[model samples]
Target: MPAATPPAPRRSAPDSRIRRMIRIALRILLFGLLGAIVALLIAVFVTASTLPSFQDLMQKPNGQTVRVHAADGTLIVALGPSYGDWLTYDKIPSTMRDAIVAVEDRRFYSHWGIDPVGVARSVYVARRLKAEGRRLQGASTITQQLARNIFLSSAYNYGRKVREAIIALALERKFTKQQILELYLNRVYFGGGSYGVDAASRKFFGHSGDHMSLAEAAIVAGLVKAPSHYSPSADPQASVDRANVVLDVMQDAGAITPAQAKAAHPEQVQFAPEPKQNSVRYFTDWALAQLDTLVDEQTAPLDVWTTLDLKMQKAADDAIRANTPKDLQGALISMENDGAVRAMVGGTDYVTSIYNRTTQSQRQPGSSFKLFVYLAALEAGVKPSDPVTDEPITIDGWSPRNSSRRFLGDIDVRNAFALSINTVAAKLGQRVGFEQVANMAHRFGITTPINTHPSMVLGTSDVRLIDMTRAFASVSNNGNAVTPYGILKVTTTDGTVIYQHDAGEPRVLVAPYVAAEMTDLLQTAVNTGTARAAQIGRPVAGKTGTTTSNKDGWFLGFSSGLTTGVWMGRDDAKAVPGMQGGRNPAQAFAAYMRVALQPRPVEKFQTDVTLPEWQLEPDDEAYYGNPDQAFGNEGAPQEGDQPAPKEDVAPQNPDEIDDRGPPAERPQRQRQSDGDKPPQLDQKWLDGVLGNRRQPQPQEQPH
Candidate 1:
């Protein structure tokens, strides 16, 4: 009975079998885990093999800085890459290196390029933060940071992180610890357009990195996490607080004693005076903007030899600063007769406002636009001495009035233009057809669209100051079309020319006589008209323009050698009370030109066109009026005096006169004589000027 009871309590075979299976399963799982770790190591090794060679790593491409030089080889500015003199590991102070390590990576020397413990901790924190919906913080070592900045784009993703880690490992294998630390210090960004520890040290302390004190080194090290946020220039107090944290960390890491950390932490940091952020910044910006179209590619650093004359640039800056009101803004552009931009002050202060009013702004030209209208009339058989009534006039339901609101009854074309009579310009624009006026402007290099309204003659159309200055240069250059250009030549640092300006054969767009007459007319303006204030004691020709409500005032003028344009207005286009083209703009023009043209020899305009007698019919009272009464005795010639005679006019047959349609439809007249036939019009020039007009056929006049 006892034996049978004991047999019943015997162990189950199934339980023993289950225990054996559990042991086998545990052994298999352990092997599988080991295989996975080995596979991961192989993947990491393969990825690291793709890294750059040691030489390639050492010669990594940092963005090149662009150096802008004036035509005479004076440095205008240096921009683009914010690099400074490269420093070797030996040149860097031990204190500076220790400060960086204490703040950036405490175990920098102990860890293999990628810190496994740091990565694991970062993953754990990241998981917790993800559950709580927080921004993921970075746990990159200095080596990892250098790898990203040197070889990778600033993309934050799993794939990018993997590549960054593998490259960091490769960097550790190829370069010594000191070399890695040196590279990191040389390539780190340090706010305010500074790159590298040397630049940062000099920018904040006005001294080289090797000469920095413990406090100064800590300040530089603190900026590594967030350069802009901790910039001393932007927020000095915040930057000081960040440096204190670095000092405490240095003390804990035994890089500095507690007393030393305390002494350095509270020490006042004297930062260097901020460098003139962008001297001639507006000009540099505009020049670089043009470089995009001028050069085929900007693959390397370029030495841009600009048309800028630094002396003239300084003059323009002084003139704008002295003449422009504090609240209001202004722009000045000075150029050569061949369209070489010599000086450009885009705004009163490039630091306060970078809006380039000279090249970017398109304000109303006001009366300054009448030059084109008068030129169109001159091309259409109207002489500068032709009769022009400055009485009230209207076209297309739009009435134009003079700035003075008083009409100068009937005046000659020269006086009418000199006085900037809005009515006469409007009437002439209507007579010659607005299309012709627009064409004339286009030929003079006014690329802005011109409305065909009669008011366009009064400069109601908006135009850039650079374009307007270029247009006036045509008058100064004897009818040659002027194309405004800034960059003379662009070359690499090694002197390989990338772009060179070759102003091709000059395009004579305006008739020679027309240019001479236009110059004469504009000279009269500067000498005795609304632009008298713009005179610079030289043979100068210019026009004054005031828009409606005094919103914009302009003085655009040129001498034999230089052409300068000044614009004064509020950036908001609001009216500046009591402002006029003859006021501040004219004064600034005069001031700048006096200094700009001081060295250049004074040259007079060539008045070469032949003169013709004034032909007056019995009923031609409008052609010869009371000059004193017309011009208020200010600029009017003593009564009965006339401007220089025009070229001879060929007698027109009565039948041929009938063939000429109404004033608006008539083709531009040709110079004709008894023995000579009328010359055919230059259709190409005409078409270019008068956009898309039917070409006129050459016709013989009956003798």
Candidate 2:
């Protein structure tokens, strides 16, 4: 009672102090609550606006795809850096499904669009492991994986994790679990420039994803965990170990029996043949470059179906690889007149380096570009028999000389073309209008830059290898210029028809009559010109080009059903000394064409019904000296003034090829480097045809 009385007298100060403290605490708590409310509102607004649709990203358009083959299910070339196309969920392999599920989320099917338990367990495990000084681990479900690949950066952070969650919810709302899983399967990286499972399967195993074996599926799935770290093709043991881990997880998750897991373990990881080692490395590399200019990234396929005849290609590749000088380089291309890429070889190897001298290098075409000049002259009513001078002439201080500086004063147009006389081409170009010749080349599908100067007649203009192939195709297609393509159809993941390649009516760049005359000229070259090296037993026509200093050499030719061109040069435009197109490139072309025609009937040239006026003058000088006398039964041309030939000679057919078999087989080819060993003129390309399915180890691509 006494203590209470004393407290009562003096308790006001204590009571007042208590009240002040309580008020301050309340104010601080209230402000924190207000701040949190503002932050929450901002976050909600930002998330609402920042969220994106998964479909939009999944559908990016690619343009003007150069398929390098027909739509009939062949693929020789692609348009983008990624060598792949998209596929749908139904085609996914069960092995891949189980493997990924076991590794990424054991209870994925049971989760209700989200896996809270998985996340919690992962956090717990992560903490335990951290305590034990181990690496961190994840607990992402398939939906989460899809969310991350589709909408989030690969970088790990708390903020990104939260965003991934929000996006995962959005994805769940838009697509079912199966659909999400499908997207994840198709979108995951599998190393080796492959973006999706379909591409991964084709690129690594040379087959469809649906056919992947359990071991293959495990390897593919394991790559998702650490693509560079566990790429089987690059690091076999590491990849196998990761695959084993996948098997262990599958066993733990009851996805596979222990026996199944053990059986699925890889004894050795075998990779699909790398392109660099392909016999058609140069051809493929060149075709790929052209496809890049034509097709867009999103629309290209994982497996490009090409116009290449695998059998023919293999033969050509083998012959060239066996015959070419080990240190020199060469390239070859083949296609049907309808723009189907039949075969190609950039160099001995295509894996380590992909620089295709055939398409990318702009070395002089030598005599190859003369086809257009001769064609343009034919269109101008210049007869094959007309004589022209092969004497040296100067244009803008540029004097043109022949490979052998001796001029055959008066030679027929056919003989000139066949012999690839530089002087005659220069003289003929002056009469035909340099611009007209350039335009004719453009019409014939020479999409590369063509120099309008008089030197254009000397093949001085830069031309890509594919463009040359297509140009030659015109002769085979009866004057129709057919654009080349590789992919036949491209569909979205949901089966929406994204693209279907359809051949348009032929563009008549030249009259069939003119094509016939051109064909005859090329035939003459095959029969008697430098292209003699290109002669096959069947009726074949081609031109051989050996530029000045031997910087570049070319052989462009065709048969009734197919057209092909070969190019040989250095990447730096350095002269290859004595190496000419007829040496390796032309021989490769001949080798490929020979086999390509074996399965089919021998080709026959189709001569034009209407022949141009034939002038029997001995040389261009004689024709120029007396233009009136040189007129044939058709008399002088009815059109513009007859432009007399300068000091030059006649046009000739493709120089009759030596019609020789491949150069005596040089040293047997070892497994060539993946198209990376300095563009060797190695032999193993599509044996000689342009369109051959690469026998991955041995089996065909689709089989």
Candidate 3:
């Protein structure tokens, strides 16, 4: 004790103070190490308790993926979790793997999941950036990212980081580095509604991940940070820039040589073509709306097979874009005679307006409504050769004028329909009774309300384009009723059928003979009447409809067993100057059919009845003005027929608007001199008269 006291007395004060400080620091360090160990244990316990089922994470996605496909199995759009083929580590291209590792975590191979050096560097940089008023950057390694993507929510916080680190460490113990990497690549989101590198590779490169080039691999690897922002389809320039950064990182990480990195120009990458017809969204939306009705609760992924024909859809979109005027909207719906919808374009731009004019909008069908009136007359035993006066007539107080303002006084029922004579349509509606006309419309699939007003004969009632298309499809289907459908089948990924379109026995809507007669009249209309613009060098039966104010122009026709309807108008129903059914609408129909029908053989309308060619009549206004001086008294009302009412609205003046074009554009009927032969279906004369007699291509077959 005396020796120790002497030694302590001789010790320097500074040395004693330093020893005390060292002892305190050692104690503090020891406590800190113990505390960290305890905290890590607690984090491990909590993370393990909250971890997702490994089997489920490996086999099942969180949400069901709904893949909508066109009739030919072309992918239209993917709705939910989009995962491609599960690629093994070997199946993944080495370039793609290296690019991901280089960009995401340079020390991925050397680190044991939780990279302390990377974490320290990331923390330092984040603090430095935070002090400069920047957003904090994360230090998630590839293992951490996989853990978060598969097992944890993407919330940034200290607790989430702790959990991610614990999970990452556990993943490192459970799987090899390559296994972790394979899982990571298969689970990452790569934008464009795609998930996983393989899906993204196919989506962007039109091939699997195994075939990716260096540039493509870099581009795909760069998509992980901010997928939407770096998407090649959304922002090509940004994607290229980000991909170059990935290449630089790869070179720095020694995954790629500098020369190789420099040679890999992502800007020159040829990405897959963008989806052709955005109009397919319209059909997809429609099909999805009916999905729940078709199947039970969607608990698993579904593979939907829709009736949409991609080629026909593109053709329809192109036709509408080419023909629709600026600021005006157009809609088209095409279907098989059996009512399977082949194509639909709701508007000029779907992103601008999603309101489906084909099914949602109801507009007056104009003279196209005459289809029901004429059909009713035909059902009532009126022959196509029956005499019908196109002269001015009033029903109650409504006086309908011919579009040309000058009527062909004594034409047969066939020519009357071909010329779109309003007076004759009105007289026929009255002759067969408005109730019968409305009944015929309902029978032909007009679901909207049809007022039995006298003026309704000129298509005053509002109808949907789909309804009109379906009605015409019924006529094209030899009088069988049609219900328009878009979905062919819905199945699961395992090839289990969920819903199959049951094309049940068609309901007989009209007599085949009556439909044939109406088809003949419609053919005559297209061949020599207002709808000559709709000619496709084939026999087509259709009608033209122009509403009172030119607010709606429509052409509903059928060729080669397909029925299509086109409508042009403003959403506000404002008049479009000089708009007519036989003009833009018919032209659009022709344009679409030119492509839609290219794959099909020409089909003639099958009918037992044929109309004999009529003798040409001169414009004898004086002879037609006097009813008694007409060709025959048959043009007058028969026994028990209702009397024609006096004119209420004055005959449309020469300047009045009509379903046909302006007065100046009206064709002048060549006067047949007393000694001249009757007019024939002269090709040159018809071309000069109708101004549109060109033949388009053939027909199309639905896949």
Error of 3 at 153 (Å): 17
In model 2, the runs with Cα more than 4 Å from the true position are 1-147, 150-190, 193-306, 356-361, 489-500, 608-703
> What digit string (tens of lDDT, one per residue) describes model 3 on residues 1-703?
4655454557889999999999999999999999998988776666656655545556747677798999999988888866788888898999999999988888899997889899888888998898999867557899999988877898888898877889988777667898888888888899987888888988988988777899999999999989989998888889999999999899898889999998998889988976654788888888799998889946788999999999999999999999998889999999997788999999998866778999999998887888998887876667677887777776775566544446667778887787676678778877777866776787677878987777677776789999999999988987777889999999989889979999986565555656777898999878767787899987789988776556778999999999999999899998777677888899999999988998999888764224436525533242222111000121223234454453233221211212121223212332233464432223343234223445543553344
Candidate 2 lDDT over residue span 444-520, tens digit each: 77767776666667676677877888888877787776677644454433445545567875455655556777888
Report per-prediction Cα RMSD to one decimal.
Answer: 10.8, 18.5, 17.5
Error of 2 at 304 (Å): 6.5
Better of 2 and 3 by TM-score: 3
Top of the candidates by TM-score: 1
lDDT of model 1, residue 437: 76
Candidate 3 segments whose C-alpha is farther than 4 A from its true place: 1-61, 81-277, 607-703
Candidate 1 lDDT at 512 equals 63
lDDT by residue (tens digit), candidate 1, 73-135: 998887765666778889898888999998888889988788888888889999999899985
User: Of 1 and 3, which scores higher on TM-score?
Assistant: 1
Candidate 2 positional error at 613, Å: 20
Estimate the TM-score of every prediction.
0.69, 0.54, 0.56
**Candidates sorted on lDDT, descending:** 3, 1, 2
Model 1, residue pairs in steric clash: 439-689, 612-646
Better of 2 and 3 by lDDT: 3
**Highest lDDT: which candidate?**
3
